[model samples]
Target: MVELTVREALRDAMAEEMRADGDVFLMGEEVAEYQGAYKVSQGLLEEFSPRRVIDTPITEAGFAGIGVGAAMAGLRPIVEFMTFNFAMQAIDQIVNSAAKTSYMSGGLVNVPIVFRGPNGAASRVAAQHSQCYASW
Candidate 1:
């Protein structure tokens, strides 16, 4: 058995999925060139190329919406946030758009996407620098 950190496990799962499906791709801030904000996307850009491993500006709503749209188009997208606190910027796209698309379309439109990020607060961080939204 192999012991893997959460980040390593997440990266491996994504690599496996990408290897298994041509439609699977990953996108997020620093996910490509910077190796992810938390280094969770370490070597994906090299393995999948820029076309599949994409980087986005800090506009969470913009990128998350793009991911949702891609999923609606039958592609599997992995959308990573530097942290879930920033995800609030894209809550509309996540809850109203992606989460509702299938039901709103009567199961005709399915959004196959993954939203990943570290949750909760880091120890010893400033109050404004940490947030926990697990209850929500």
Candidate 2:
């Protein structure tokens, strides 16, 4: 078996997805021009170019909504939230917009987007994970 680090695995997965589908694109804070917040997406911009791997502002809700809309419009999006805390800023978009797009469209439109973010220690909230259960 190939021994790969967590970052390598994630990078490979994203790369594979992007390669398999041209519509699949990743956008979020630091994803491009910064190599990701945790550097997991390092070299992706060079490999996929800036259009596929994009960087955005600190506004999660705005970008999350954009991702959802893009997905509804037939483009696959990979939305990175940076962390659960950051995701909190887009909880409504994730739940209401992305999650319910198909239902709201009468089972017609499909929001084929992937939502990603850091977990556990990234949040730095020890023993407070359960508090996010309801929000998630």
Candidate 3:
């Protein structure tokens, strides 16, 4: 058995999937040049280039919505939120759009998108940043 950190596992999963499927891509802040905020996407941009591994601006809502739209268009997108707290800014796109699109479209559209990142508490983060919205 091999052991890997959460970050490594995430990177490996995306890498493997992208290799298997040409339609798989990733987009998020720090996902490219910075190797992800938590380093989960380390080396992906170098390997896949700007087209497959995108690095977006700090506009979470805009990029998150774009990812949802891309997924609806038959591409598999992996949208990363630096932290779950930041996800609140794009909740509508995630909850009402991406999550419900497949059902609303009667299965005609498959939103094969993964929205992920470090959820829950951060060791030194403050109240606004450390809370876990999943429990609520």
Best by TM-score: 1
lDDT of 2: 0.86
- How much is 56 displaced in model 1, in angstroms? 0.2
lDDT tens digits, residue span 7-53, model 1: 99999999999999999999998999999988999999999999999
Task: Arrange candidates by TM-score, descending.
Answer: 1, 3, 2
Model 1 alpha-carbon miss at residue 14, Å: 0.6
* Clash count list over all predictions: 0, 0, 0
Task: Name every residue pair that clashes in candidate 1.
Answer: none
Tell me the whole-model lDDT of each prediction, alpha carbons only. 0.93, 0.86, 0.89
List of clashing residue pairs for candidate 2:
none
TM-scores of all predicted structures: 0.95, 0.89, 0.94
Winner on TM-score between 2 and 3 is: 3
Query: How large is the C-alpha RMSD of every model relative to the true structure?
Result: 1.2, 2.8, 1.2
Is candidate 2 or 3 superior in lDDT? 3
Candidate 3, residue 7: the lDDT equals: 81
